[model samples]
Target chain A: AQSVAQPEDQVNVAEGNPLTVKCTYSVSGNPYLFWYVQYPNRGLQFLLKYITGDNLVKGSYGFEAEFNKSQTSFHLKKPSALVSDSALYFCAVRDRTNQAGTALIFGKGTTLSVSS
Target chain B: GAGVSQSPSNKVTEKGKDVELRCDPISGHTALYWYRQRLGQGLEFLIYFQGNSAPDKSGLPSDRFSAERTGESVSTLTIQRTQQEDSAVYLCASSLLLAGGRDTQYFGPGTRLTVL
Candidate 1:
């Protein structure tokens, strides 16, 4: 079974500083990875995805992630943080071998706090 | 007309009561999914529906949880005899296609379920 792990439960960064949220995955085959953000009482919003091409994938709200096959990691990053960017972020992975019907497995999530 | 929409933005029900959550996927989307999000937690895949075929109900937690979709448009997730553990936000998402490589899911605002 494919699984994802987010090492940190919360990450705090000042407004204008760079931020990083770590994510790792274990899957049998090539992995399709995704990042999502959820605001208070809102649904999960898609951020970015890495399928089979470039290792670096850019997403909405100035967010981006690097997919490292060797490390089995896909960490979300931003050059600078904004207070509006604070939210609950999730890392998800699905095995490419499962064709089109397999479900995505998500990490426990990491809460990002951007303080001024 | 816009994105995925869920009905009854907030639902408060007593323990042992039955609750129904509705999801209306974006028109022309061929795949629909249901997920649960507890406070401070990531998304848990609850079920997946593709077109009019039988849904992938494997992610359901127990027999008390069930879901139905008509044709390929709207979906309803039904929880029988709800418990405190069932107090979480139920999210619905839709994708234009089912192929795993390039499918991106758009989510609804979610229905917050609180069991008292």
Candidate 2:
């Protein structure tokens, strides 16, 4: 079984300050992790994905995620949070061990509020 | 190039009625997927088509849910005997299938379904 957990229901951060949204996962084998953002009235947009290699993967809108094997965590981070960054964030995972008939499983989602 | 798109941006229907949601994947992309987004829950994988062949429909909630694609271009997801619980936002996504693993799924604005 594969699952993702987003610990926070909402994360409040001050604008121009660093921000982090937590995520953890449970999977049978190595995981293909991804981060996506959803704005109001819009569908999810891919931010970044961690397939292999570097632990830190950079993505669109100055977003990045670090894959920690030991902790089984892939947290989305931004150097300086912008007011526009306020949106819903989701963490998803897929078992890389099996290539066929696998769909990405996502967490409940975290609402990020960047105060100006 | 246009990204994945979905028809019927918003639909309101009475219970027991049938509804159809459409998706237009990006040109040259061979993979298309459908997901459901509940009020608080994150996106749930519903089904996916790999070049007109769906290898996985396990995520679909019930038999009332069925989907089909035409030559990897457009897809239609139909729900019969719609129930109040079926009210949700139907999201469509597409990804390049060259490597499958390396490509990210790009999502559309989605169709907001309201069951009355």
Candidate 3:
């Protein structure tokens, strides 16, 4: 079975500071990892994904994630935090072997709070 | 529509009542998915449909939950005798076919379902 873990329940960072939201996963085969963000009353928005490529992947809204195979982690990062960036972050994974219709297993989510 | 769209943006119903939520996937999208988000939690995959293949209902929580897709465009999720636990935001997403494991999903605003 595929699963994802987000160790932090909440992450607080000052404006302009670097922000990081950690995520780890377990899968039977090569994993397709994804990062999504959700604001209140809205559905999730895709941030980035790591299919197969360089360890570093850039995504929308100036966000990026690093896929560390050895650590089984895909951590979301932003060079500078903004108050508007505060939202709930989720990490998801699906077995690469599964077809496009396979469902993604999501982490418990980490609330990101960026304060000015 | 420019993006995936869900109907009945806000629904409040008494317990044991049945409710139905609808989703309109992006035009030409061959894959659609349904997910549930409880308050303060991440997404939970509910069902997936791809092209003309049978829909995957493995992620559905119970038999009371059912969904149907018309070809590849619109989908409807129905919950019978809904319980308080069923209260959550139901999200819909769509993506292109998965040939290289790089399909990006676009999400809808989601329908907030409240069971009293």
Superposed Cα deviation of residue A85, candidate 2 (Å): 0.3
User: How far is B76's C-alpha from truth in model 3 (Å)?
Assistant: 0.5
RMSD in angstroms, all models?
1.2, 1.2, 1.1
RMSD of 1: 1.2
| Candidate ordering by TM-score (highest first) | 3, 2, 1
Best by DockQ: 3
In the range B45-101, model 3's lDDT, one tens digit per residue, is 899998788888988999999999999889999999999999999999999876855
Task: List runs of model 2 lying over 4 Å from the truth.
Answer: B98-100
Candidate 3 lDDT over A1-116, as tens digits, reads 78899999999999999999999999988999999999888888999999997999999999999999999999999999999999999999988987655778899999999988
User: Model 1, residue A60: what's the lDDT?
Assistant: 95
Tens digit of per-residue lDDT, candidate 2, span A32-67: 899999999999999999999999999999999999
TM-score of each: 0.96, 0.97, 0.97
lDDT of 3: 0.92
Error of 3 at A17 (Å): 0.7
TM-score result, candidate 3: 0.97
Q: Candidate 2 residues B25-48, lDDT tens each?
A: 999888888999999999899998
**Pairs of residues clashing in candidate 1:** none
